[model samples]
Target chain A: MNWDAIFTSLRLASLTSLILLVLSLPLAAWLAFSRWRWRFLIESVVALPLVLPPTVLGFYILTAMGSRSPLGRWYADLIGSPLPFTFEGLVFASVIYSLPFAVQPMASSFAAVDRNLVEVSWTLGISRLATFFRLILPSAKNGVVTALVLTFAHTIGEFGVVLMVGGNIEGVTRTVSIDIYDQVQDLNYAAASRTSLVLLLFSFIVLAVVYSLNRNSPLWPTLRKR
Target chain B: MADAEKTMTNGARPLQVSIKRNFAGRFLLDVSFNVGAGPGTVLVIFGPSGSGKTTVLRCLAGLESVDEGTIRFDGEAWSDTAGKVFVIPQKRNIGYVPQDYALFPHLSVRGNVEYGIPRARREAEGPWIDRLLLILGLTDLQQALPGSISGGQRQRVALARALARRPRLLLLDEPLSALDAPTRSVLRFELRRQLKQLDVPAVLVTHDWEDALGLGDQMIVLSGGRLLQSGSPLDILTKPENLAVASVVGVETVVPGRRVRRERGIAQVQVAGLNLWAADIDQPGDEVYVCIRAENVTLEIGSATKSSARNHLPGVLLGVVAAGPLMRVKVDVGFHVDALVTRQAVEDLDLKVGSPVGISIKATAIHLIPR
Candidate 1:
């Protein structure tokens, strides 16, 4: 019952999460430590997806990446194909939709770190990069793990943006959520129920893992003891 | 000025710092001082919070960039704002111990100490860390995380971690301020011993007068982000330049007056409706403040006697307040005078709120500050 669709969704989610993590790490670090006055403007812009309607975001991305637009024409000329209605387009859309998920936790964790620790490390002759790896990352490991999980799960459950940008191409753009929608519309009740159950189990398992990890994180010492 | 010349002649490689910074058009810090960073020399910066004592220390360590002026350590320029010669904190070869004792929470005591050991020198100098831990009594606690240990132990670990670097200069910012009173006194003794043994030029900033007097080889007093005076602790306590410096160095009373006459070496001064004679009057008829320390004023039950003390005044006891080991006796002759007496002395004299007593203070004990 649409096993290829499920696998495609998993692949998309994994790739999007990996790319988002890479892109967001330095951005989050800068947001945490920079003294720039316009930092809040950038932060607000990054957080826009958290409250923006997914359809509106998808419509904008579609318009910006369509074959008629300048970016879409340039992409078509360079990549030999238009960006919209493709697997690549789906990945890009998911990354944008799940950006706040990846960034907020990381940025907050980075900001929450004691500045004295960083200064102490620097005075000890530890470079900024070394300090980030040896001290900052270990201290903020919990938030990072949460960000990765949220981004992956959010991408897996994406429907509105993926539908608008990817256009339901079989074995390529049609992920599990899109397959389930198609099944319900076609009155394939048994198939839709099976797919829905899989998603429900996946969501519960992801949340369970996150909660257990959070309990063990040293940031919540009381909860860890409990 | 004589001390500066003597320090220069001793080949002790002094750190010369003169900086002026104007911050936000509200605060200005103008300070200039030189300290001979000879072996076993401890320079203490004493001031209240927000007085820029820590700022001066940070500037010397290259932690704070100066707006104007230069900082030179052993003839090497650490910062010269006009010349655009500024060294980063890491390259300054200094061990800085902050007030919070910022130990890496993830690392054990041993790991923290070894953090600053250069990779090339780690093999040859690695044993120094163990030696430092042993000296600081942290050998058994080497495996413990900073949070797992007690506050006093964490302080030792911070000291050990800084010393492990074998730094050319050491800067400590109120290292013992976080401990309990008992622990603080205990650690202070230990820290003084360690600083002596390090044989490195060290600057410590503390608001506690006890630390300044007990640990400092030279003391620089600061107030309101400005240098009030710089001298030996004894000199600073006995010859403070102004009323502000006098109060900071534990002088309890500052009576403003003018010297009316100088007969021989003694100067008769009119102070608060009483005529008191102070010795060593270099400037006659000068407006001055007579600073008196509570400990210097002895309480006598009878009238003025022919004792060694040159000045005596009869006064009625205003109050007896218990202050730790000593009793603070407030007396009013015509003006209030405080005498710090022991509990045994209070009980022996049967002194109460209204008992009349005589306060005998020597002419030498009175410090003068030009008003």
Candidate 2:
């Protein structure tokens, strides 16, 4: 069992979780409280990655970020680079793949906020945007935390999306989950065992934060802790 | 009633809610009323459930949008459908206290009160907030969360929070409904005093007759999504517009019949269950409603020992129902009438079902409504 791989996966998961947390808050607020009737449509679109296969996202995103596709060409032509095969590309894919774990919690939490409070805030002459930032977000602290931890851990466990798009670029796209798989494919039992241990431990801690905070997290703790 | 006074005031920013909502199939709510807010004034909307009292406040607060109506505050239009003017609640600067108080469980008592206050107003809000808490007797519980607090304390917190906004108008939707009797009494008195201090226009919605009489300076009786009557509480209770309004004002009897003739102040009406005379009348009709207060009727053993009361009828006691400290004796002569009697009087008479008794109602006590 390699402590180093476990630590690396833990760090990657934490970072991914942080990134997902920042993105889901506003999007969830819009979906939850918007007067717009068409929010359901936007909600369904965001939830697409939850139901669709990871490979589908990998296929679409990979094409869009590749040199041949128009967006890919423009990205490549403008910046002399593409997102595919890069660590940043993996982060983006992880965000897309684990979006439901982050956004849904936010949407439901925001919905549960006491609408009277919102109304009171408005009657106090506070703007809608201000109400969201101060009232809606503060009340939804628990939901935001859950989304963060789940997205982070979910991204850490990714295999299909990374494999399709992020070709094992060491120190870049070679996330700990992929490294463990590579070890297994080679039938190097010692290396595979080490990588597997690291992945397990990394997942354990991210999930630990999630459980300790809110037991209603997507994943539950199998073993009880005092 | 009185407890809600300090808790909710409608001052210069009176909640002048006017709404006209039309749904596709059957649901249609058209109601309009003004709630006076200022010290020593309470506007109580009395009605049964589903009478649109709650809807009135919701429309005013911008919680429920009206298809056609106007909600104005202090002569400035809060919402006027005809003028295409509507103001969002968050932008309206009014305090709305709902039935359940709806305090955030995660927030402390102080936190709950400080919720709608902006960053700039926060510092300035402390003294006033503390005063409200002290007035509500929730000073010690400031740091406690709503979940850990008692129902009465939670109510006080809601009141404090609403007051902390220093709102121009206060709208309370049955604030004390969930509270027990004892707590309600104490809070009611405390609220009355505070309402006087706020000097803001306030409206309190309740179905309880005692609540309306005790708390309201002006009472608005609503029924079937319509405003039946709105005026001084005494006027509303003393002179209701119709049977529905009479019921809201706690008038015990609504004799749905007609006036046959009128001579001087005594008007004869052939009520469905009995023959009674109203001392006041404008027109004689084939169909009219007669309202009688339960306490206005007096009962005696025989028809001889007459007093200042003008109308007397011989009846048999049908049943007696205990209402608070008094027992309401249901008597049937030709017409069944309810006479509220003291418990001690009930024991003296040994009041039981089928006991023969003479029921006498004063001439002035009989109020007639032309149908």
Largest TM-score belongs to which candidate? 1
Candidate 1 falls in which docking quality class? medium
Q: DockQ of candidates 1 onward, in order? A: 0.66, 0.49
At residue B216, candidate 1 shows an lDDT of 85
lDDT of each: 0.85, 0.76
Isolated chain B TM-score per model = 0.93, 0.87
Q: Deviation in angstroms for A24 in model 1?
A: 1.2
Docking level of model 2: medium
Chain A TM-scores, per candidate, are 0.93, 0.85
Error of 1 at A111 (Å): 1.5
The top-ranked prediction according to lDDT is: 1
Candidate 1 chain B worst ten-residue window by lDDT: B277-286
DockQ of 2: 0.49
lDDT of 1 by residue, A85-204 (tens): 999988888999999999988888887777877887778888888888888988777778878988999999999999889999899999999999999999999999999999999889
